[model samples]
Target: MKKWLKYSLISLVILLLIGTSWFTYTFFIKEYETADENVDNIVDTDFEVELPDTLEGDLLDKNESTDKNVNQSKNESTKNQNSQGNNKETSTRNKEQRDTENDNSKSTNSKTQTKDNNKETKNQTSNKNELTKENDNDDQTVNNSPDESTNSEEESEKTQQDHVTAEDIKNRYRPTFQALQDQALAKLNNLVAYAYSEYKKKKENGEKVSYGYFYKKYKSAAKELEAKTDATFERLYTSLQQDLVENGYSKDEASDVKAYYNQKKDERESRMLSKVLDKF
Candidate 1:
């Protein structure tokens, strides 16, 4: 080969090498710069959203506030329920107390009424017992015949049927010891009345009869009765009061004697229960 030809070939090769290097540099430079710009844009816009952090924080605060308001409303409702329950309990207790007081008052009244009824029944029973004892005290006839001793049971039965309570202490009277005592007392009391009546009569007739003069005559008559009787007038009068009904004195005769000694008192109370009774 010629020397010049070899040199030319070498130059051509060198030129080819330079051209290829230029094309690759032009294309690759543009691609590298575009990648760099894309990297910058990703860095600027990465991890960013449409909604701001400030706005998200406001939404979270609003949600928390709403939850707090609901909780407060629930607490207020619970408090109202508790208050209503307490009020109902208080009302029930008050009603029960009133009922208890009423029951106690009714019980007290009932006990008082029961006691009164028992006392009345006891008084009636005592009066009946007294009458029975008086009837069993003696055997007597409705006649003043003390010397005639009759042993006939039939006659005694007939006499008991017509015994005592006879009017006017004359000869025909109950031949009991009580009746005889009452008869003697009646005679003395009648004599005392007659003595006073005679004094009044003398005073009305303008006689010189003072209280001393009347009392002297009354004592003289009392002395005569004392000498004729086995017992003194004072002793007999005391015995008559203590042993009137118990010594076979009739109720009518005893009542007459009592009328002379005492005044009638009030009537007895009733034993009926109360009209209004508790139903509960």
Candidate 2:
């Protein structure tokens, strides 16, 4: 029995040892497997963490590129705006310059036209002055005609030694010429008196002499007076001629003197006639 008991105890010990070894091996192996699995899981977790950082870096780079593109767009837009503004300023300046030039051209044209107008006015004024001078010359010519005629007659008389001067005629035969002139004047006065009386009588009789009556009577009276005046002057001229011959004057000189006396007498008669017509 003691031997069986010892064997049984040894068997129990062996079984226990086997069980312990199995348990130890199982525990160690299982622990080693778990450590390997943990290592794998840690590697996977590290890979996941690094993947997120790479994605973040890529996003930051893309953001920087976008910023650069935005900045470039802003610069391009500013340059375009500046160019537009410069072009507009240039256009405005050109317009102003053109306007100023046009104004200057217009002013020049106006000044030139004014100068031309002034020249025309001056020419017209000069023409008028010339015309006035011509008119003045004509008037002078007309006024000098009588003096020229008298001068020519005096020159002819100067050629003769026996030509009677005005002083000589006044001292020598003035009384005779005066007596004859008075006689003629007295006759003309008497005719004027008769015409006045007739005009007064007709007016008082209420026969306001019509134009025909007045004209006919004046014409007849003028004719009678002219005939009487001519006859008286002829007698006086004949007497003067005879006296000039007695005074040692040539016939031609005597005739010329008589002609001068007759011309002066005729001028006096014309003045008297003008006065009479004015009264009528």
Candidate 2 TM-score, C-alpha based:
0.34
Q: Which residue runs does candidate 1 get wrong by more than 4 Å?
A: 1-8, 17-51, 55-59, 93-97, 100-104, 107-280
lDDT of 1 by residue, 1-280 (tens): 5999999999999999998886655443322212223222322222211211222344356556555655565565556556655655665576567557655665777666776656655765675576445433422321212223233333443444344332423112223333434444544545555555666678789997544444344444544443443243224344443343443454445445434322211110010011111110
Candidate 1: residue pairs that collide: none
- Whole-model alpha-carbon lDDT for candidate 1: 0.44
Please state the error at residue 4 of candidate 1 in Å.
8.6
- lDDT of residue 56 for candidate 2: 34
Give me the displacement of residue 155 in model 1, in angstroms. 99
What TM-scores do the predictions have? 0.23, 0.34
Quickly count the clashes in candidate 1: 0
